[model samples]
Every structure is written in C-alpha cells, then in structure tokens.
Target: MMLENKVVAITGAGRGVGREIALLCARHGASVVVNDPGVGGGGEGGDAGPAQQTVDDIITAGGKALANLASVADPVGAQSIVEDAVQHFGRIDAVVNNAGILRDAIWHKLSLEDWRAVIDVHLNGAFNVSKAATPYFREQNSGSFVHFTSTSGLIGNIGQANYSAAKLGIVGLSQSIALDMARAGVRSNCIAPFAWSRMTASIPAETPEQQARVERLKTMSADKIAPLAVYLASDASQGVTNQIFGVRKNEIVLFDKPRPVRSMTKTTGWTPEAIADELIPAFRPSFARADEVSADVFPYDPI
Candidate 1:
C-alpha cells in the first residue's frame, strides 16, 4: 500500500525490468501508464502487445493501468504519452525513464549510425520524457524520476561505446534534474540494474561453461530489480536524490562518489622539473586511493 493511488509512467514497460517495475507498482496500489515502443533490443519497431499485456495483467489484479505505444525517442510522442497519463489519471506522480537500445561495436568499428541510434533512444529518450514530465511535476509540486543507467556505463564495457556513453549520460542528467527539482518536491535518482533481460539475450553460450555462466546470471531476474525502483518512485525516497544505486538479486548497493584526491598549488616560477618532481607522484593512479601516501602527503605547504 506504499504506492496507493500514485500515478506512475514507465517507459519500456512492455517487458524486462520496466514491466516488472510496472507490475510491482500496481501491486502496491499505483495506477500505471505502461509505455513501450514495441521495439527490439536494437530499436526496430513492431507490435504493441507487450505494453497492452502488462496493462491487462495489472487491471486483472484490480489495479488501474493503461497502455501507451509511443517512441520515447520522439519528443512529441513522449509528450503525448505523459499527456495521456494526466488525462486518464488526472495527475502524474512518477516517471521511469527505462526505454533504451543497444548498438555494440569497438570504437574503431563503430559507425556514426550505430552511435546515433543508441544515443537517440537512450539519452535523448530520457531527455524527451523527463522534459515532458517536468512541467507537470512542477505544477503539481511533486514527482519522482527513476532513470535507468547500467554497469556498462558505470564501469565501461567492451564493444559498447555507444550504449555505455548514453547510459552514463543519464546519470549526469538525473543528477542535474534532482538539484533543479529539490524544492519542488520532485526527486530523481539513477539505477544501475543487473537483471537478466532481453537486452542480454545476444550473449553467446557456445560451450557448457559459457552456458553455465549465463544460467547463473539468469537468477538475477528482472522481477528482483523492481522493488527498489518502486521505493524510489514512492514517498519513502523523498530525502534520497542525486544518488546512484546498483540492484541485483536480493542486494542493493549504492555506488560511491568521486572526489578530488589532492589539491596542488600552482605557483609562479615553477618549472617543468618542479612539476615532474612534485605532481608526478600525485598524478599516479594509486594516488586516487585516499589512504595512499602521495594522497595523504601535502605537496605544497601553505604560507
């Protein structure tokens, strides 16, 4: 009953993590707008059954729900989807920016088309939906945004330059929105979820060993990632914003933030030799550790 009477709009709700989030929200008493473009993992458009099916399941369970087959990559479509939620539910309370596409390629092999396709859907898609929902949230003086990021983006994955860049961009976007909406009672947070979904179907299983790894990963179902999302979308997370969370199985981990390791004094008459001697140790990657001697030692004494 945490989400009783709450109205939430979820992009990519047709299947996978988005679908699970919609179902969980409904189970807890939310009225959901299940939006999906019916696109494949690569963003090719197709049928609308996925979104409709989720809505049907929710309604069957005695929950309020609606289906929207709109491309979040399109600003007009994104706006219309939010408008539909407001028109049907009479208010918009939360948005899950979960729609995305994958275009994997090494940096040199990556085409402009491949890069643009991923960016358009994942990065621009979040922007389109968030922008459309912001006015309503501002007007209502309350809203929550759960933006989907990925470990690929957080830690950098192989052959996913396009996908990783777009996902990381969502983190920056959510943080900025969180700061902007602080006083408006709107909260925005990023979720890096490790769930076995359609997005990872292309992972190969050529050998029994490979298949075993895949099977192990499958244990982290999409359903397991939904509860954290529902909490973030509810009133319980009002004080939580501009944060990043990693969700998998029964564990939820918050990612640590970055901070400057050492501050150097740039003084006049300092030569390249002086810079090499003093700053080189500070520039070492190990200096990133707070407990490292170089990081703990003050390179320059203050007057």
Candidate 2:
C-alpha cells in the first residue's frame, strides 16, 4: 500500500495514460478523483460516461473513487475539482495534471484556433489545476505533483508546434513549482512518456510499412507508464523534484537539464563580425544537428 489512505486527483482520467494512472493509484490504496470532461480527442464535445465508467471500475476493484467532470482549463471548474476532492475524500495528497488534447499541424499550416486550443488545454489546464490545489498542499505541508510532458517538446517533431510548446512549458512550470514548494514538502516532477495512447493512435499510418511499425509500437502500452506515475506520487520518490523522466517500453531515460555544451565569452563586447568569426566556429562542433527528433533517439524497442 504505497499510497495507502492518500487522496489523489487525476485530470483526464477518463482514458489513456490518465485512465491507467487512476487505476494504478487506486490499486495502490489511493482514493482517486477521476476528472475527465469526456471531451472528444480534439477537445471538442463532452460526455460523463468515461469518468463514471472509470469510477465504477475502480470501486469494483475494492477502491475508493469519485467522478469529477471539470475542464482543467476553467479556473473555477478546476477549483471545484480541488474542492470536490477535499469534500469527498477529506484531503488530497497528490495532483496529477494529465489532461490534454492534440491539434497537430505543421508550423506553416497551423491555425490560431488550433494553437490556442492546445495551449489552453495542456498549459493553462495544468496551471489552473495546480494553482487551485497548491494552497491545500501548502497548508497540509506535504503533496506531490506529476505533470505530463512529452518528448515532442523535449526534442522536436515534424508537426505539433503547439503541443511541443505547451509540453516544454510544463517542464519549466514543474521546475518552478518544485523549487517554490520544496520547503513546504511539495514535490513536482515532469514525465515525457512514450506510450501508445489515443494521441499516438491518431497519427495516420496508411502505408503497409507504417502500419506494421504502428503495430509493433502497440507493445508500448499506457499501463507500462502507470507504475512510474505511481512511484512519483508515492513517498518512495520523495525529495526527487524538478527532474524530467521519460518512459519508453522497457526503457527509462533521464534527460539532462539544459546546459551550455560549449561556451566562449568575450570580456569586451564583440562586434557582429568578431562573433561570426569566433563564436560560430568555436561552437560549430558542439551544435546539435538539424532535424533530431524524439523517435530518432529511441527508434527501436528495448532489448
């Protein structure tokens, strides 16, 4: 019972990674608040069925759960989720900001509506949920936050400019939250999980070769990622804040925080010409090659 008696609220718990996290948390003895607006995969339309179904499943497995239908992007709605947890379960020990939607388009072809939609759901949604829940965590003097990020943001992707921006924002946001709450015993960490969730399933793979690749990728199940989220939510990973972790099939990756790979300082301000001559050549060897992406880093399944 790693999370015994703990109350945890997970957004987007209706399906995919969020669904798995809720189930795993409950199996580990946590009372879960499954929050899902039941929106369509693109964040349109809604239903209560998904959240309710998850709750029913959890209870049937001998666990406590509450169904909450609140869009984490709405401040008042997000606040209601925190309040719902406190009122129903007595206290909330963890908040997992797993709510998200996908609106993928190439940078040149991306629309403003699509951009805002993704940002609001992923970035603002996380902020709203975390902001509403932070005061309680501060007062309780203990809590954990697990924010969902993606390798698309960590590295780069062909399309998904909005998603990449929003996910990277989560990384920075988690770091700041971790530092700000360290003295209060609140830990925040980000995870870039490579699993076959609804988001990945949406990718069009029409060619036979692409279809076969997608089939092999089915091995990377959402359930495989739940254990990491469970550990991060439990006391086992205490004092491990502000770190970014990646889970890909049987492999786990620890990404290095941004640091200068090579540095050259000019004590006196350098002219543009001097910079072109010195800086360009000095850093050329260390420069990242063009078009490196997440898939390239871990293309094959783990041995």
Q: Best by lDDT, which number?
A: 2
TM-score of each: 0.89, 0.96
lDDT of 2 by residue, 216-249 (tens): 6678888888898999999898889999999887
Candidate 1 structure quality by residue, lDDT tens digits, 1-303: 889989999999999999999999999999999999788889886679999999999999999999999898889999988998899998889999999877787789999999999999899999999999999999989999999998777766567889989999999999999999999999999998877888877656688855765676677789888999999999998899999998767778788666676667866766799779877767775454432221122222111
Q: Count clashes in each candidate, considering only residues at least 3 apart in sequence or on different chains.
A: 0, 0
CA lDDT scores, all candidates in order: 0.86, 0.91
How much is 292 displaced in model 2, in angstroms?
A: 1.0
Prediction 2 global C-alpha lDDT: 0.91
- Weakest ten-residue segment in model 1 by summed lDDT: 294-303
- Cα deviation of 143, candidate 1, in Å: 0.6
